[model samples]
Target: MIRIATPDDVPVIHTLIRELAEYEKALEEARATPEQLHEALFGENPAAYAHIAQDDATGEPVGFSVWFLNFSTWRGVHGIYLEDLYVRPSARGGGHGRALLTELARICVDRGYQRLEWSVLNWNRPAIGFYESLGARPQDEWTVYRLTDEALESLGKRG
Candidate 1:
């Protein structure tokens, strides 16, 4: 079963985040605290929303997907930007990931979202294939950009 995550699930979500980071060989970058998650998901102004999938019989969480709303200037409609999707290795192949994606897609369709977007690591071939199997195409024309804390600080001092 998949449902919106609650405050009590923060710890499990954090654990899964770490596990996913480890799988992606980026564990060093996974340093989210429960407080951070709490504020991001449930604070007065939320930054994102999370959905967790649980075992129907055991009630143990098996996977989760986090997303946030984005506005597309071209489409002039709100869309969903999937930030993360993680399924425990042991719990994979149980259709958890597919189910989660289907649920998110349903939300987009129901709400008239013009697009749903996410980025996959170039080396993650399995994920790329899986997304392709779902009829998702890579947007080759665009490149993603980010500014880290040090970069932001430097920009502030550049004046």
Candidate 2:
């Protein structure tokens, strides 16, 4: 079963996020605290939303997805930017990942959104194959960039 996450699920969600980071060999960069997650997901003006996937029989959460809406100026419509989608190592291969993605697609279709997108590490061949099997194509022509930490601070001060 899958359902929208509530404030109470923030801790579990954080745990799952850390687990994902570990799997990606970037656990050192996982700095999201539970409080931060709660505010980001449940604050008055939420910055993101999350969904939890549970075992139907056990009723225990086995995976989670964190996402937010992004505007496509060219398309003139909103799209979902999936920040993280993680299924517990033990619970993987149970269709939880696909189920979560299917739900996101359903949300996009229901809201008349332009697209649903996310990034996957190039080294994660298994994940890449899974996404490809789902008919998701990589945007090879576009390069992604980021500004954070000292660079972000420098830019803010320069402005």
Candidate 3:
């Protein structure tokens, strides 16, 4: 069962985030505090949203998706940018990942959005194949970039 996250789920979500980071070999980068996550997901003016996937029989959360809306100038419609998606190792092969993605695709279709997209690490063959099996083709022509920490602050000072 998948449901929108609530304030009470922040700790679980935070745990999942750390678990994912560890899986990706970047646990040090998973720095969001549970309090920060709570604010981001359930704050007064939240721009982020999350969905929790539960074990149907046990009602225990096993995975989650964190996303936010981004506007495409060409499409002129808001599309969901899936920031993170994680399923616990113990819950692998239970269809939790697909369920989470399908829910997002449903939301996009229902809302008339033109696209549903997210990035996958090039080295994650399992994930790449999973996405391909779902008929998702990679946009190989594009490259992703980011500015954080000092560079971000430096630019902010410029602005």
Candidate 4:
């Protein structure tokens, strides 16, 4: 059962985020708090949205996918940028991940989004294969760039 997450799901969501970070070997950088999650997803101007997969019989959340909208200048259409997609190890191979991804793709098609994009760690071969199986290819011509906390602060002071 995949559905939009509500405020009440924060605790479980927080746990899942931490679990995912640990899986990615970045547990030390996982500083998300309940308050931060709430503000990002449910504040006056929500920045993103989340979908949770729950056990059909037990009603316990097993995984989640969170995303935000992005605009492609070339295509002139808004698309979904998937930020996080995680399934508990026990839930893997159960089709939950595929189902969640299928739903997100459906949303893109229905809404006429130009593209759906995300990044996988270079070492995560399993994820790369899964994405390839779904016909998502890596954009070899482009490199992802980011400004960390300190860099962002410095940019502001450079003026």
User: Of the candidates shown, which would achieve the greatest lDDT relative to the real structure?
Assistant: 2
Model 1: lDDT equals 0.92
Poorest 10 consecutive residues by lDDT, candidate 4: 91-100
Higher lDDT: candidate 2 or 3? Answer: 2
Over the stretch 3-37, how does candidate 2's per-residue lDDT look in tens digits? 99999999899899999999999999999899999
TM-score of 4: 0.97
The TM-score values for the models, in the order shown, are 0.96, 0.97, 0.96, 0.97
Give the per-residue lDDT of model 4 (tens digit) for 1-159: 899999998889999999999999999999989999999999999999999998878988999998999999999999999999999998888878888899899999999997889989999998899899999999989999998799989998895
Give residue 67's error in model 3 in angstroms.
Answer: 0.5
What are the lDDT figures for the candidates, one per model? 0.92, 0.95, 0.92, 0.92
The best-first sequence of candidates by TM-score reads 2, 4, 3, 1
What's the CA RMSD of model 1 in angstroms?
1.0
Positional deviation of residue 107's Cα in model 1 after best superposition, in angstroms: 0.8
Per-residue lDDT value at 34 in model 1: 92
List runs of model 1 lying over 4 Å from the truth.
Answer: none
Candidate 2: clashing residue pairs, number: 0
What's the lDDT for candidate 3?
A: 0.92
lDDT per residue as tens, model 3, 5-112: 999999999999999899888999889999898888899989799999999889999999999988899989989989998889899789999999999999999998
Model 2 scores a C-alpha lDDT of 0.95
